[model samples]
Target: MLHETSRRRLLTGGLATLAGLPFGGVGRASTLFDPVPPLIPIRALPDRIFRTTVCLRPFRAAGPRIESERVGRKLVVHNYGHGGSGWSLSWGSAEVAVRLAMQAGDRDIAVIGAGALGLTAALTAQRAGARVTIYTKDQFPNVRSAWATGTWSPDSRVAMANAVDAGFADRWEAMTRRSFATFQSYLGAPGDPVEWTDRYTVSDLPPEQARGFYRAQEVTGFLHMGDRIADISPRSQLLPPGSHPFPTPTVMRNSGMSFNIAMLARQLTADFLMAGGRIEPVTFFSPTELTRLKQKTIINCTGYGARALWADESIVPVRGQIAWLIPQAGVTYGLNYKSVSVLARRDGIVVQDMGPNDGFGFNDTNETVDIGAAFASVALLAELYERPVPAVSPRTDP
Candidate 1:
């Protein structure tokens, strides 16, 4: 794992370098009220970013299901299949699965998977007055949710075939709003976890392509919030339409909620345990092994593993790999170019391009994808997710 101190120093050095470098005489690293260069159209969408999009299929659990052994009859509730949005859709999805499990008429719930989805499921059950037990092969730290850029989820563009539906869009929007508010409740120093800030999303296209899901103004309310000024995200004039500094045509900019996923997960899990939630770290390869599960209700929060556990073949793998930067202090916002490349994140910068097509996997040396693809994704996401990017160069006095 990369050390925090070293990452900070690296980011500081990079910031200093940018501060001194000439960007029309201004700092090029400004996120708010700074000029955003037009996105230099880098060959089609996936061309310039994340050089490679490895299928996370390897990590995708397979079998009578991925990891299942039947020691006994353990009624299980499987919950998974949240590709990149695992952290973002965790709570909303968790609520859905938990609700189902609770209906099983059992006070004891067993949750599989330790990522954001799993952690949130455990906490929700405990809150609802249920005795929750979390069983997993790996702990929180080793889970992928801890590695996310920690952005607002529902990663709308991801692959969701058999299990999900078109109406999922509505559920996704609702979940985003609910989750954001829930996350806001735990923001503080001890949590060092969640915070709100302005995220300038720079784009080089018209509002349609730039705004993404919000491209339709009608859904903005349902998706964001009713409050045009605050509650929901709206496109404002952070910069003149044509004044965008980058090579793109237009820019979308907005401030958003962010978090240190790893820290947040740790804190949430700790709270869950304190609230009387149970944890069984022992891995059960067979469904029968779980038979000892005295709990009448079992909530399955296993991502990918759901394929075999329930014999749900609809669930497929969309691989994703994240490139973590050293860490730049005072940087809380995020940026993305299309959904392919990204740089703005709570912990640090990350470039990812793993979806249904590219094949799910990981490759560390794909830096070429980082510079271009991730950069483009940041530009696109900034304009759509947050506010519009400023046209004025950061170096400029104005």
Candidate 2:
């Protein structure tokens, strides 16, 4: 097994050297991002599972609504429906939402929801010299954002291509670039909340076949909009079997950002508190409730809750589930294989199946654990690494 020191070498010196060669059928090195280290193979499954949780990505076809509305004396700014990009686009979205809320000329702000978007909004507003308070049904640790895969996936199921606004690309690109810049500020900080990792896309087929495989999912109209802002993030490139490290026959690799969800939420919440922001365990059943708050300006970062609370029928829930195993500290990278993704995080190793199609999770609000899918994803990874699929360990009553 390669050590951490070797992994670093592969990512920096080794990969960079390979970039100068015409490897992976690419005629030139300029086509690839700086060489990235491959994920260390998982040798064994954990004796105990850590957790399984589901999150309904608040999806909207027209993209996130950042408009302001008048509710009695309160000026409410809607900042929900980010779909799976909630964490990835939090800072940029929050910046836009708060900027709009600031136009109300209110010295105080109320941000609903305790997820990534909410915390970021509260902190952003507070930094602008506004007294901010977060009102949510659950605290940071209990929010649905905790269940996300935590990758910098700005375009993941964000919208149907035809449904977005005419100028959506420009707006979306601005938010993505800004968010990418802001996220960098948190890198190398405490808790490894924000960090870079090599995310490999492994397959047995050739590059063309793999592209065809992914194209099958794109037929659903959920386009991969990563290219719009690809300049800000690393780009993926093919790595032929001979040069790849995974036991798989072929692989593609890229270095991208990831958030340790728990660590990120904890640190953001702490930063908000230390900056004189207050959070109340409060839930609003309807839009009218915003009038009850003394704060005249409200920024709603409620995610999927907007579907009912704000009567936003356009906001759809794309439910996603993840099965987590005990943390493999030695495994510091991630992989996308067989329509399933596995990421090594500070909290745990996350295994999730994206299903046969990209839209498989569309409108699926069911929170129940799909043990079959979870286990199957693990089995797929086990096969890729040429390791035995571990037997199921008995579960204990909670």
Candidate 3:
């Protein structure tokens, strides 16, 4: 029997071998020599937690507002309210907003809000040969986008199934694919701004028993459009009883890209400035205030701030919080055990409680960090490592 430390080293070696292959290449039989999969423990303790942050995701029942409207002499293109998908869909949504702004035949484009949407829009406009200027009150690190979960969740809380039109899925697919392709360009760059990592879902219950978890969490019935772009994402593989090292009875694994927001933000800011794009520290009290800008075309990427800035009551706030643990070397995977989700990124290890259901944070506008709640999530994660490893069945294969 392999000791805990030996198991981790073997797993790390297996992971290193699998890392160079494509996303789903872990399925290769050569990597399955061990009867039981290796385990890499997360040092999830209260003392290791460095910080906690809270952010409000702007959710619209009808989906993100990507339309053009006349605001005095300016053609304002609205591109906010992407909910939890802002980071995942920013590039594609930027493509749409820039297309609309360019239709106004303006050479100088102004982007409001320097969050994920704003930076991407400014960069995309620059790519379109426009002189872009970002007008915002705060820059990266201080912006709400900096507090995002930093995962590839394109359709997460993006829209309501009943509220959107029939054509919305097609548009969503285009945005997801475009954003996915653009993220691919950032791979292999310094600091690993964007890269793929394997994620494990650990559960005590079997697959059939856990199928109803989604139904229990749906409060507003948000649309699940992952199926539309299924071709791009790798399929989840169920780890056999003896093939995974977890206290839980069931484990499923999948590979997806995660963003190291701090690194990605720096890269994006440098890209925008190098391309001759400018950022001005400015704030707008209302839509009519946009007329004061010298650029005739403006893209509004205000996110949840739009609820007050535009008096848009339709934009609901979905609250989320992250508890950051000091980065642990060689811990590069993600985990979902119980309600807590943990991702090991270059910046920090992110631990979050997804709430009781999909509606756990729906319509919540609170931005205060709950230290107790954050610690509770860390406690839950610690439970996985504290419990004794379960016995595995013998391998039946030759």
**Top candidate (lDDT):** 3
lDDT of 3: 0.81
lDDT of 2 by residue, 1-398 (tens): 11111112223433445656755434244345454444467643534356777888898988888889999988899898888788888999898999999985788899999898899999889888899989999986788888888787887777778888788888888888889999999999998999997767666665556555555554467645654764565545555433455655446666768899989899998999999888899879988878899888999988888898988999988988887877875788877777677778888888887767666788887989877677777777777778432343343334
Give the lowest summed-lDDT range of ten residues in model 3. 1-10
lDDT of 3 by residue, 107-220 (tens): 899999999999999999999999999999999899999989888888888899899999999998899899999999999999999999877776787644443443454556
Q: For model 2, what is the C-alpha lDDT against the true structure?
A: 0.75
TM-score of 1: 0.62
TM-scores of the models, in the order given: 0.62, 0.87, 0.90
**Candidate 1 ranges beyond 4 A from true positions:** 1-74, 158-174, 189-191, 203-231, 236-238, 241-249, 337-340, 344-346, 353-398
Predictions: Cα RMSD each: 11.5, 8.6, 6.8
lDDT of 1 by residue, 1-398 (tens): 11111111222322334444445422322443555443332222333232322223212122111122323465555666655456656676667667767764677777777777788989988887788788887776666565555655344223323334456556656666666667768777574677665444444554344443223212111122122223453223334444443444543344445667666877888898899876777776656656666665666666655556556665555445564543445544444333344444444555554332222232222212334544554454344434433464334355
RMSD of 2: 8.6
Off by over 4 Å in 3: 1-38, 395-398
Candidate 2 ranges with C-alpha deviation above 4 Å: 1-39, 43-46, 387-398
Best by TM-score: 3
Clashes of each: 75, 0, 2
If both were scored by lDDT, which would come out higher, candidate 1 or candidate 2? 2
| CA error at residue 164 for candidate 2, angstroms | 1.9
Superposed Cα deviation of residue 98, candidate 1 (Å): 2.3
lDDT of 2 at 329: 58
Question: Cα deviation of 300 in candidate 3 (Å)?
Answer: 0.6
